[model samples]
Target chain A: MPKTIEEINAKIKAGKAVVVNAEEVIGIVREKGIARSAVDIDVVTTGTFAPMCSSGIYFNIGHSKPRIKLEAARTYLNDVPAYSGFAAIDIMLGATALPESDPRNKIHPGDFNYGGGHVIEELVSGKDVCLSAATYGTDCYPRKKLETWINIRDLNDAVLYNFRNAYQNYNVAVNVSDKTIYTYLGILKPRMGNAVYCCAGQLSPLLNDPWYKTIGIGTRVFLGGGSGYIAWPGTQFNPSVPRTEAGIPKRGAATLSLIGDLKNMQPRWLRGVSMQGYGVSLSVGVGIPIPVLNEEILAHTAVTDDDIPATIIDYSRDYPQNLPDVLGEVTYAQLRSGRIRFNNRDIPTASLSSYSRALEIANILKEWMNQGAFLLSQPVTPLPGIESGLAFKPLNYRPVERNNSS
Target chain B: MKVSRKIVLHFPARLVEEAIAYRLVKEYNLQFNILKASIIPDSEGFIVLELTGEQEDYDRGVRFLTKIGVNIEALSQNVVRNEDKCTHCGACLTVCPTGAFEIEPGTRRVLFMHDRCIACSMCLKACPPRAMELHF
Candidate 1:
């Protein structure tokens, strides 16, 4: 019998909802089969904790006594620069934004220890951050220089508004060159000494809800240890990638843009990450609930790590040059085994994503639903899926028109 | 009683050129294995090594180094892994020369084995959260 989201909500409200995490759902489906499991389970929760670089936070820094226009000012939070293109006291700090003085690989594999991600983590942890700004004086707003300590509670509103996060799948990074390479995937040893992949496999959000069946805009989620919502299909949300028989993408595919209040977020779930040679990024924890409304959704939740394939990419050559080359393909199950056979050589593998944390988040979300503290919401509008023909295009370089004024 | 101690020796600028390993072997009958060393001529330097010998000889070897102005400390004291900070993401597993990190079979949890760690400090930079810290 097919169920609607309304029916699922009723079960959740009345404490009759059968909620299980993505990991547990796999076993249940194998035991009872999808047909029977679909009726037994009401929701399957998914989670992922990894360094999502395309993430940021925005806030309204209440007006000062003399009102300095932040839009025209250069503002820095704890030495990391931020975007102040909005109102006088509005600011948006990206997770990867580095300070002007950051060497940034100038010394070859530079140490980018702190950035906007660290500032955001500190703010969420209730630490006071140094807010400094310099601007040209205006008649209405005379204060040109401002320096203050700002806490999360002091701000009128602090929001985590990431543009792209929770990637459906990603590549396994390796280095084929003679020398080692430092990348966001961590250090890739020379000659494919090691491989690095970032994903929670069966526990990942989009992997469980492949094709965006139940995960869409307005979908409630467990973000940064707090409740958040899916704002829209994430940036570069391409659904045209090659897929497996079960409809899961074989490469990096769907993503989600999320929005949540930062005040109640926990530091453990929102951590600042520093990769050698690579700039800082935020390790965000995102959990999505899949309403088991039908057998199809239950079958999707039953997909295991062996069914998910990841493309192996050479970071030293193919990646930096934007070359369309794939070294090999391996399954998440092989990756999690700690060793992968690539080019007849046994290479150790590591993951940037924490599977344990992802499991923890999924369990927490499941508990929330079982306790009737959380309810599933139907998508206001579905994301562009495979039928939409949405294609992800790269930037084409062109000469800038320097003398437009002439 | 035989004893093996992994220690770090800080050599002063003048003592940088001293054949300390030779002295430990020839004079104190201690077998020394240099794990790592960073020394530049006429500059302060340090060497990490494992010294094994009779307990009495090991104590005398340490006293002799101390008498010669060689600052000695345990190798484990220099490298530290903060349990609270470690998200156990396994970034350090591949980069480490010695297999200091092992993923538990079922849980997939990364366990940091400090005993096998040579204090290479490779994990310090590779760790996203900077969980693996080096004090010295």
Candidate 2:
């Protein structure tokens, strides 16, 4: 039988309910060895363009010319806290374009064009929230970095607590290029054909040394910056790659891979594939320790620019095209011969940042489990209705302005 | 005018038949009453729960369960939809614990009723085609 609301309230007020100290709960998680659980990260991106202005509107009609023109920008960012055995995060990056080629400099007269950026607000904890910048370098703003700390043992609790607290400080920095405003009929107009670029990246890094080794983990290389171009009309220019400190080309085609001990890997458990819409796909995989599956070991491998033919005998493979028949035949022969264990299909490359985040979260959770500080909480309600696999959401970080001039 | 809040306590479906649910009620001296106690199958497996009490009581009840090694999460009212990218695989059908999905007879596409969804995310893991997504 359901207790009356009044009675429940009275019990709560009387302190008769079970209340465990936060530290005690942490201790319980550590003792339970729940940190060995692996964390998976996923990322996604969507893009849209600013609509073209009507010819009559640009020329100004007989009645009254509009002064300010507004464009509708449709974008969304989704972040879901860890509910069950898994947690997910999602973010959407978007922008508007200002063209350089136009007969009548209607919009703004400036040497450089303009593009819009996105801002993300996250709820970190029940009481404390933090906002991080989601956008990188652009004409108006410098490149921004986002950072987050996860409590591995109590991942579910920590995530929910952090999300609520982190969201309170949400603010995104907008870029405004210095351009002369041109007006017609007392209204300012933006130049036609000007374009803006928007991009998103996924980062998931497997921290378990054993897992890393099993999957052939490689060195952590930072891919430099680049603007993302939508494959739609009204795009003023092609996406430009951001430069790196080593003067390496920031943008271009690239291939990455993980190689390690394949003997003890659980290929069947690996699931799904996703990619960054704007930039090169950042793909990652980790190997499980042989003796203890809970222990993850980072692997060592090399990602080359050369288009190497897929090796049929490898434990797992990810490629953009079909493998050579010889390699495929060899791989099949090896599988039948018990030379390799390949249970899952090929997983495509994903966003580098999203993969990195997932790895980081997984590693932290593992550590917490090792310390017996992690615990799995039951859900009060069922999971969400949508079927999109657990998507990884990025942390939104913004820059804080310092009043140095004072 | 004063606003009154109710709290509810929920137990997992697996523990419903066991004495644990009753023990929790007796030990805690909880005023909350069990609403629905049953075992339900989800994508991950089976889960049991006992829904009892008001909103405030619910929050307190979660804390109480947390003390006993049971986890609790709040439910939000949000409708999620997949854009045109969905490939229409039937993976989501098996994951819906509440029987929220129905097949459109003509198209054979899966139709979703948000009201019945418990949001356990079993279908997301079961999907092989990389379609089917959740909206905020």
Best by DockQ: 1
Instruction: Report the C-alpha displacement of residue A69, candidate 2, in angstroms.
Output: 22
The list of candidate 2 runs beyond 4 A from truth reads: A1-321, A324-406, B1-18, B21-74, B77-79, B82-102, B113-116, B121-136
Task: Considering only chain B, report the TM-score of model 2.
Answer: 0.43
Candidate 1 docks with a DockQ of 0.70
| Clash numbers, per candidate | 0, 125
Query: What's the C-alpha lDDT at position B93 in model 2?
Result: 46
Instruction: Compute the lDDT of residue A348 as modeled in candidate 2.
Output: 13
TM-score of chain B of each: 0.67, 0.43
Tell me the tens digit of each residue's lDDT in model 2 across A1-406. 2222244224334544222211122233344433421111011011111111110000111111212111111111122111111111222212112222312234333211112111101111111222122333334333333323321222222110000000000011111123312111011112211111111111111111101222121221111111111111111111122222322212211111212121121211111222111111111122111111121210111111111111221111211222222223111112111123223332111011122223233343334334433322222232211131322233366889999999
Chain A TM-scores of each predicted structure, in the order given, are: 0.98, 0.18
Deviation in Å, model 1, residue A339 alpha carbon: 0.6
The superposed Cα distance between candidate 2 and the true structure at residue A270, in angstroms, equals: 32
What DockQ results for candidate 2? 0.03
Real contacts retained, model 1: 0.82
